[model samples]
Structures are given as C-alpha cells and as structure tokens.
Target: MPQHRALLIGASNYDMRGIHSLPFIPGDLARLGSALRRRGFKDVQVLSQLEGGKQLGANFIKGCVAGFLRRAGRGDTLVIVLSGHGVHAAGRDYLVPEDIHEDTHPFESGCVPIDWGRDLDETPADHVVFLIDACREGIEVASMSVAGVTQWGRQKTDAALRRKVAYVYGCSPAQLSLYVRDHEAVTDGVQCGTVPGESFSIFSRAISDVVTSHQGALALDVFREAVQERVSLLHQAYRKRGNPQLLRTITDIPHNAFTFLPAAAGRHEAATPPVTEYPATPSRSTSPWWSTPASPPSGLRPQPALTRTAEEDRLIPPAPSHSAAPGRGQAAGPVGLPPRLRGSSPGPRHLISRRRVLLGLAGTVLTGVGFTAWKVIDASTPDRQLWKFNTREFVQSSPAVAGGVVYVGSGDGKLYAVDAATGEEHWSFATGEWDASSPSDSAVKSSPAVADGVVYVGSQNKKLYAVDAATGKKRWSFATGGEVYSSPAVAGGVVYVGSRDEKLYAVDAATGDERWSFATGDRVDSSPTVTKGVVYVGSSNDKLYAVDAATGDERWSFATDFHVESSPTVADGVVYIGSYDAHLYAVKT
Candidate 1:
C-alpha cells in the first residue's frame, strides 16, 4: 500500500535573541494539521508549542524533518507545511528555527536553509508538496520599508523528492507576509479561512479552505492559479502588498491530477483492499492519459464530434478578476469557492485549459469506479516493475547490466550479481560488514562498470576492486586516499573513477596500476563520462571539468554552483548532469 505522510511545523515565539517572536504561529500549526488530517494524510506530525509554544533549538526541527523524510518510502506521498518567521541573508533564504544564532561562528543560523536536500542523496516519496506560509524577506509592515537582505527561500523539491513536487509560497520573493488582526465587518467577498476575529494569517487560512473544499483534488496548475487568485484577491482587497508565487521549473510536465482530498474522501479509498501482486504487463491498454479526442468543457455531456475547430481551440478564457474595495483598509478575508466552479476559469500555463479538461471528464470513462486520472489529456507512458531484490540497506549505486547478470552495490557493503530475467540471486561479494557489526558509514555503495570480462567498482573501504563479472570474485584491488564513491567508467585501456579524496584517477583496466591522476578543488563524486578523448566530471567545488582522457591534462572547465553528485551522461555532443542548485545542465562539446 502507498503511504501518505505530513510534516507540519509552526515555530512561533522564537528565542528573541536570534529570531523574532510570533505569537499566532500555534494557531497555524493546529489549523494546518487539521486540514491535512481532513485531506486523508494518514501519518501527520505536528511540532509546535513544544515546552509551551517555544522550541529550544534548530537541531530539534532538523531532527524531526529528517525523521519524517526517513519514514516515507518511494511510493509514498509527503506534504510539508511551514508557518513562522523567515529570514534571507546574503543570497540564501533560511527558515528561522527557535535558537538561530546569526552571530555565532559559521553563523549557525539556527535555520533550515533551502538547501535542505544537501544531506539527502535521494528520497523515497514519489509525490512531495511544500506549502510555505512565511515571507521571503522581513519587512516592517507598520511602515513601508523592507528590512531583509536577500531573496526568499526556495526549494528544489522536485530534484530532492526525485518525483513530482508542487510548491506554494505565502508571498512574493521581495514581499513580507502580513498577519492582520480581525476586525468584525461585512465580508460578502471574504473567503472561509479567516473569520471576523480570527488570528490566522490570510495565506494559511486560504490554503486550508481550498484543500478541504469540493475542488480538493484540483490539478496542480489549476490549484496553483486558484490559490494565487484567492490569496492575491484577499491581499489586494485588504490593501496588503504581498503576492503569492508558485515555482515549478521542471520541464515535460505531465497532466496528472493532484488532489489533497479530505479524510472523508479517503475513507472510501481506505476500504479498498491492498494490491499485493501485479502482473508485469497488463493485457489491456490502461493509461491515465486520453486515447479519445478531447472534448470542450461546454457542459457535462459527450461531444458530437471528436475534433474541435482551430477557432474553438483558441477560445481560451481569461482569468476572472475580482474588484477590490475602493478604500483599501483591510477589506476582506479569503475568497470562498462554490461546490461547483463558477465565474470565469483560466487554463493551465501549458495546456489549453485545466477547467476545460476537468469539466469534460464528467461524462467520459475517466471518472472511473475508483481511480481518477489527474492528467487525462496527455497520453501516459506505460509503467511497470520489472523485478525486485532487497539489499538490506539503501541501494545508492546504479546497477550495471551485462551478459544477463545485473551487478549492484548496496549500503550493506556487498556487491550482488542477480539473474536479469528472474531477479534471483546468482552470487554476492562482501567488502565489509556494513549490514552486520561494521560502522553505519561503511558500505559498498559504488556502481559497477563492466568492460571486457571484469567488473570495476569502488568501495567505502577506500579501495577499487576488479571483480570477475561471471563469478563475482575479486581479481585485483587498488587503494585510494578516500572512499571510492564514484562509479568506474572504462574507455580504451583505462578505468576512470573519482574519489572523495579530491582526485580523479585513471588506472590500467587489467593490472590495477595507477596510470594518471588529476586534482580538483574538492571531493569528486561525479562519475566520469568519456566522449571523444575528453573526460567530463563534476566536483564539490562547483565546477565541471573537461580533461584530456589520455594525458590527464587540463582542457577546459565550466563552473556552476555544482554541488554535483550526479554522473555526467554523454549523448550526441552534449554532457548532461544535475547539481544541488536544482539545475540539470547540458553542455555542448
């Protein structure tokens, strides 16, 4: 069964020395938790008001977030919500923890920087959403001056989650999120989250209302626009200066629908039996994407024709605009959504329209007995599991498939050779006792690179081993200055790999003799990709080097904020690699 987890954090009343004190954050914590629980999140952790509405330190929050992420498996869904004071310094934005000490050595910001994914190589959750109810920079709302120094904190959540991620920011990068005191007045255009005398922030309250409403399962794009319109309208009506922003940079967007439905909506899903087994390939064609021609959202009925005219395709609707009160003095709360959408609706950023497809699905076969496809307009690729093998610990190493045998390394400190057809274990070679009595950090996590009849791989014990691919037996071992986290790439007579010792080495493929080595500024974990006698790799020092494959001499280098651990993949004349800064770059040779 797929798991659903939520981490809701509200840090108010922070240690005044290091951070500002917010009194109403407890309300946000409680309200957001209730909203997520209502939306069918089975595992919800709400941490706020610890020791009477005040957490002691930043470590507490980090430990909790790490633990929460650890609980989520690859097939799970995770939602993380944060509400509190936020600070931006230099070029990075940070979520202020209770004990942030900006004046200390290395400035232990007592904060969680947006680079929270630095500690994670991968995550198990397939769908992760982040809802931030804090401003990017600090501002004096009473006055009209901004006090913060840098841009707001943003998450490369898509890269970290290794899945689909949607983010909703409370305010614009340079704006401050306001917390207004309630004044009882007429609220015809007011939304449901804020009340006459409520203390909730305008953004958080709006988020709760939308997630619990009938449109709870709104498509990601529509949902983003809807939330933006709601928050923007409310802020504008109240004469507040903040605007909500949604950042989704990943390309090749899918049409899958994402609904954070209410718990009552989940009760029906919970009653269904779990799927214990599945056939690799289904006989029938079953895709969440549409095979039939799209019909317009005229009403809840099928179309007379399969195709639409070009003129009709261009009939896209503009986003409906709401009028703000003439005297902008805190005009209204959030905008309330009706059971069925009304007024004007806008389309997706890339698609023709989300409302059009959603409204059209009412009469189609897509509104199935149980599952409803989120993105029903595009054709979805077939998804199926080929095989499975448990490796005791995490499998950070990529598998090398050769001669019908799949060679992979695990955190268990073992290299496994499994049958490619049936996933049965053929043999295993242990370099340490990582799964047994060895230290937790010890393991054989390097990917195996096969060439000729030898399997070249790195180990955590600071050694590179050449194992016989067919027999899983060690042929030779070469020592390095640091752990061998880089996967080996074989070209010509050289086996090239990088080590955490801040060097890339070229060793003889058969004899294990060190032929040449190149030094870099920091650790080199990126596996080498060879193309046209040029060896390409990235380093912790934020650079991608193109070196002479034969002489290990400097060719040319491209610099980036390359917290790069990704192996460079060469295709045609491009070298593709990913960095911690959340960019997948393609460099031309």
Candidate 2:
C-alpha cells in the first residue's frame, strides 16, 4: 500500500534584522496539516519555533529535510511544505532559516538550497509535491541583489525535475501571499488569529479549502481552478489596488497523485456537494475542521532523528549577537530634584515665563540627580514643594505621564515608575549594566514610550527593552549593533528606534522582533517620531529622514550643515527639526 507523508516547516518569528516576523505562519501550518490529513496524508510532521526555545537554523532544517526524504521510499507520496522567508540567489532557490542574518551568505550555509540533486530528486518517493508561500520581492544584500522569494522558472523547473513531481509556489515571483488580517474583514471560510483559528497565508488557505471541502476524487485541473478562483477573490478583498498574486506551478504529476480515492474506486468516486463559501470554504459537516483521525497502521514507520555532521556544525554556527550585560543590584531610595529648581531661592523677584520655568525644571532634572516635584510661584500663593523621588544616578530621560503614573529612565541603567500625585516610587526595572566606570555606556538616555500597558525604552548598552508599565517586569529585549540613545516611538503595534550602527529599526511591539531596518550614513542618536504612516528621524550624518513606517524604506531626507540631534516634530504636514548648524528646519511633508 502507498503511504502519504508530509513534512511542514513554518517559521513565524524571525530573530534576524532584515526579515520581518510572520504572525500567520503558525495558522498556515495548522490549516495545511488538517487539509492534508483529510486528503489521506497520514504521517504529518511539523517543525516550528512554536515548539518554544528551539531555533529553526539552517543546519537543523536541512537535517529535518534529509531525514524526512530518507523515509520516503518508492511507492510513497511525499508533500513538503515550506512557509517562511525564501530567496533566489546565484540562479538557485534557497529557503531562509529563522536565524539567518542579512550579512550571512545565502548560497553557502545560512539557507537550505532547493535543488534537484539532494532536496527532491534524490528522494525515492513515487510522487512528490513541493509548496512554498513567501514574498517574491527583490532583496538587496551588501552590493548584490537577490530575489526575496523562490523564482522557479518554467524552463528551470522542467529541467530540474525528471520524476512525477509538482512544484507550486503561492504567488508569482513578484507578489507576497498576504495574511488574513491584512484585509479589512476576515473571509468567512479562512481560519485566522493565534488560537485554533490559525492565521494562514492567503495561498495556503485556498488550497486547504479546496482539499477539505471536496469529498471525492479531486482532479488536478479542478483543484487548480478552485484554488485560483479563491486566490482571485482574496486579492479583491485585500483592497490594495487589486494586487493579485496568482498561483504559479510547474508540474507533470498525474491527477491521481493528489486524489484520496482508493485503488478500487472508479475514475470519479463522487461529486462533492456544492460549497457556497467563497475564498476557501470549509466543509459542510458540523465537526471541527481541525479534528484529527485515529493513528495509522502499525507498519507506518517514524522518521529518523535529525543529525548533523561535524562539517555542517562548523559551517553554520548559531547566530551571533552582542547582548547587553545583566543588571548589578536592586536599590530603593528617594528620588530628588536639584535645589536650583526651587522658585523660592530669590534675592530679587524676577518675572519668569512659563516656558522658561519648564525649561529650567527640565535642565535641573537632567543634572545627574533624582526627579523633583517643585511648586512654581504664583500671585495667589508663595512658592512651595510637593515631594521628591531619587535614583542612584542621573535622570536624563524625560518621564512619560500615563494613568497617573510617571515612567522615566536613569543613567544608572534603570527605569523607574512613580506615582504622579504622591511622588512615591512604584517600581524600578534595570535594563542592563555595561561599564559603570563609563556613564555613557551605562546610561539609558532614551525617553520611554508607554503604550498598551508596555513601556518601551532604549539603553546606551546597545539594546531596546519592552517592560511592563505597572509591574516593571521585563517583557523582551532586542539587541542592536551599537549604543541606542534614540527614544522609541510606538504606533500600530510597532516600535521604531535608532542606534549608533547608522540604522533605524522597526520592531514588533509585542514580540520585540525586528520588522525592518533603514540604514544611514552615520550613527543615529536622534529619536524617531511616527505619524500618518511616516517616521521622521534625525541622524548624526547631518540629515533628517522620513521613512515609511511599515516597510522601513526611505521616503525623503533633508540635509543640514551639521548633525541633527533634535527629534522631529510633525504638524500641519510639515516636519520641524533642529540641527547643530544653528538652524531649525521646517520641511513640508
């Protein structure tokens, strides 16, 4: 008897900087696994980051692929599903691992090459199906350019596969198979979200719909037509100028290869009832779509344990990172304000403007002491004092006032929260320690951004941290190549910040995963201001840049005579920023 086996690998969270995390991959894997089972794929194995701390590195993925292929002998039908970042470089297709970095060489050891020699053709399976769902844009690396997704040309695919094989890509070599949440409304038939609803890529959802809904022998042409129709409808629902990602496949496999009919069944087992749901409909049965069946027969064998040679380990080592050091100790003390902020220290009563008073207060707060609550003099009463909260070091990072709580960062590598009314310390979170002897390396100069109960800030120790606003518990940390003096701006579930590595990065607010990065000529100490889907930030390279918040692509930049350290302020479609050249620039958006 012929057995059906499947190996599905989905990479949702990426640690690398250039590639963004795909929140939909887990869902895609579940939906496809269910669909394959319904079509009689008995042995389904999945490998993903959802397994917890396990990293889907290049060597691990290659080992899994080899192990799965070895078990698929003659007369077996094998399905290999790869859902993640893929690329085409040097005329070869490569599946990018989650740990692959921008500087890693793709063709060498960082990526798994999809070729005929070892990945597919070497397998003894009678029938093989390869499915991929990834972006198809061009990736710019170093000085050379490569395709962001697998681009299997017709001629190349034809020459590569000699056996009964089917190669299907979710999109053309120029489109991205979108996620269900990207649309205004989720389609009725497609499953989405992080729970049982599994977020699937649009292309995988369509295929699952066709396979699960159909009850009888499914013809190859019919399956193709159904999937194409679903994809077309989904593209229209995207509402992004009708950007359609048509299915692209090059196959010579027989129609019966994908059908679930028994050997004794006739040419057409039965016509399934008409499924009314558009864009990947579910079955009419009331049972859950993800319900599983009983175990396979005893003859079914398990795949071999994943193994890697010494050479493989030497060539593809774990991804390197320059993580920040751990915090030293916890201290509790009263935060204080400099005495200069006290308005009562007057030899002569001089008129002080409100702006001047606030400026003086800020100047005093940043003078390497604690924060203070000072009372300004008024005509109704004399000058007074409320309270003071002190940290062990300088309080340079401005405080964020939210929900009657004040959040601020100090040069001592700690973020403190205090009650706005009582000036009492609530909690303190130590970001990390670097060199205590060098204040610049230990300071948290970036002001905090509090959003959705999370406080985001950057430290001089070359990292950004997401901490709980109320409890001061650390959520996650992201490492950059250099010191991060730039404050973070949170918008649309993304955090944008700058680093001394001359790059501005956009990270996922919840997971602290890098979405994208935009490079500049010099260090980027100036903070970023995000508004209207645009991020305006200044760089030490003597330029202020406007970048697309979602893609990290540069929109425009204004050059100044000297470095621009002032954070940009956008109002009435104009960006206002100051530079060291003794000028405040106001550029139209």
**Cα RMSD, each candidate:** 14.2, 28.2
TM-score of 2: 0.42
Q: Among all windows of ten consecutive residues in candidate 1, which has the lowest summed lDDT?
A: 275-284
Candidate whose lDDT is highest: 2
Local distance difference test, candidate 2: 0.64
lDDT values of the candidates? 0.59, 0.64
> Per-residue lDDT for 1-589 in model 2, tens only?
7787888987667776656677666655665665565456768886765456666887787788788887786778777888777776765677777777667653335777765456566777766777777553323333325645533321244423633677777765445566655224433333221112223467776666545443344445446665766565545433334455766565534332244222211213353222231221222342221211232112321111112234323322322243212321111111111112111122211233334344444222222257776554442343544567887665668888788888888877888898877888899888776344444455777899999999999987789999999899999999998878899999999999999778999999999999999999777879899999999999867799999999988999999865677899999999999875446899999
Model 1, stretches more than 4 Å misplaced?
1-24, 32-83, 88-390, 436-440
* Candidate 1 local lDDT, 35-59, one digit each (tens): 5565567887877767654564667
Off by over 4 Å in 2: 106-109, 136-144, 150-155, 158-160, 186-199, 254-589
TM-score for candidate 1, please give it: 0.49
